[model samples]
Target: MYDINTKRLIKTFTDMAKISSPSWGENAMRGYIVNAVKKLGVTARQFRSGESYNLLLTVRGDTKRKPVLFSAHMDTVTPCDNVKPVVSQTKITSDGTTILGSDDKAAIAMFLEGLRYNKEIRMPHGPIEILISCAEEVGLRGIKEFDTSVLKARHAFVFDSDGPVGKIVLQAPYHSTMSIAVTGRAAHAGMEPEKGINAINVLSEIITLLPASRIDHETTVNVGTISGGRATNIVAEKAVCVLEARSIDYRKLRKQEVLIRSIAKETSARFKARCAISRTLEYSGFTIHPDAVISQIAATAMARIGIRHQFEVSGGGSDTNILNAAGISAVNLSAGMQRVHTTKEYVMIRDLIKGTKLVLSIIDIMR
Candidate 1:
């Protein structure tokens, strides 16, 4: 076991949080990490990207075993810029005016702290790689664009989950983003209301027919955003809704999609409104077998670090979905991020220390 520098970890976190990095605005964070790692005698390479960049750092460990990749997203959700991270007695948080940037910053600090501790203590381990991805908050964009074909690691751990430090998310639901467009005739609301088919009315019918909330324990639907209506005096000519559905079961997920499409077609026919529906598979769901080596390794590591091993299934998808799709087995590890993507986001100093220890334990588990 190695001791993590509590002060150094906090400094890295507050420094990175103050960078004000959003999805596309990750260059500053990347540059900071590159320089920070270089100062630790570790070389990092940044890949060229359009708005965001991906960084990779490789360090040869004591053995010839396969490398284990540790991943953390560089970007936080909106309202991240101008973040004022405040370190208190037990945790670090924001001033409530902006997000704390702890969604992944906590994990970023843990990764760096783990590296420094491992190097100082001369921990016996295999090769190690750290992947700092950008634009993950937007839609896992960085990992999507990253060339996984160039990666040599066979196993990966994504430290971006919420909850305690030992939570291992082995499963997540498949996600589909949908756009519903309705076109109807415009007319005077008071005068020729009968002549116009109100698109808003049609949209309302569609919404009523679809599941507006959780369909089941593992399934859900949400009409996240809606826009329509030109003015209060006239009947709306067009209405649109952006929605998403997710489910862990493939059959249930497909059935939900079919039901939504059927409702759109039926409602459009009944109201004489033109309806256009488009759906994109955002990410496929993944479930790792509990008996797999990765899961066993994480369990052992957590136990070694004196943290309770908790296996969980996330209702939301993550970079682990992309990694599993790309043939790299991975799990999402909780980095003690609480209330992420919100103004209440915060990370505990205790969990940060524990998380860093867990990472080091996982590395030693391999040896």
Candidate 2:
């Protein structure tokens, strides 16, 4: 059993939450983390990734043991500027005006505390790598640009899931994004309404025909944004819509994608309008068996900490997906973030402490 510095852990997390790290703008948060880690006598290697940087820190240990990787992101969703974290006896929350930014910061704090504890007690461990990614909230832009060839570890653990500390995400969905642009003849609504194609109407029809919102147990789709019409008095000549589809099974994802494209093509032809469609694979899905060594190590870590382990399949993608696609076997572990991506997001103090202990335990198990 290991003792966690609960007060220090909470302070670190709260301080980090106050930093503004919106996607594609994580320089300040990256600097804060680098300084904190340096206090523990750890040096961070910076890799330029898009608008920000991805940080890597390696702790030397027994050469005979295989190295393991731990990862989290430094970016948060929007409305993160000037965040204020309110701490109570039970949990930490924002002032209801802005998000608490616990989506990934809590994991960073846990990593820092684990390193601090290890140094204080001289805990014996194997080679451990810590990766802090940038722009993860913006479609995983940072990790996508990062070169995985530089990593020495074959197995990685991502601390970015939203659940209790004991939950382990073994499966994540393949994510794909779609952009649709409908083009039609523009005409004055009052003068010649019939002469205009009203692209907005055609786009609406296409959306209605497309499958949406919880397609199945393993699949989901959503149309996130729509924009059209220059003025209220004019028939819209062009309209655009952006949506995404995700599924744990690649076949299901592909089927949904095909169905969407077919609907757009057929619908536009019927309306005598031109439709332009663009689709991109955001990231591939990943699955790690429960019997895999990484999963077993996580289970053992949780069990040793008196927590019941739970395996879960997540609908969202994280750095874990990119890592697995890059040929590294990785699993995402819950960092106790609840109601993430919202102003009401919060994390429990107990969960934070337990999560830190779990990190330490996993490191010990890998020794």
Q: Considering every candidate listed, which one attains the maximal lDDT? A: 2
Q: Counting only residues 3 or more apart in sequence or on different chains, how many pairs clash (N, Cα, C under 3 Å) in candidate 2?
A: 0
Q: What is the C-alpha lDDT of each candidate?
A: 0.88, 0.93
Q: List the residue pairs that clash in candidate 1.
A: none
Candidate 2 lDDT over residue span 1-367, tens digit each: 7897899999999999999998878888988988988867676899999768999988888878888899999999978988989999999999988999889999999999999999999998888899999999888999999999989899898999997899999999999999999999899999999998989999999999999999999999999999998998899999999999999999999999999999998998898889999999999999899999989999999999899999999988999999999999999999999999999999999999999999999998884
lDDT of 1 by residue, 234-290 (tens): 999899999999998878888888999989989988999999999999988888988
Which residues of candidate 1, in runs, are more than 4 Å off?
A: 39-41, 188-191
Per-residue error for 126 in candidate 1, Å, reads 1.3
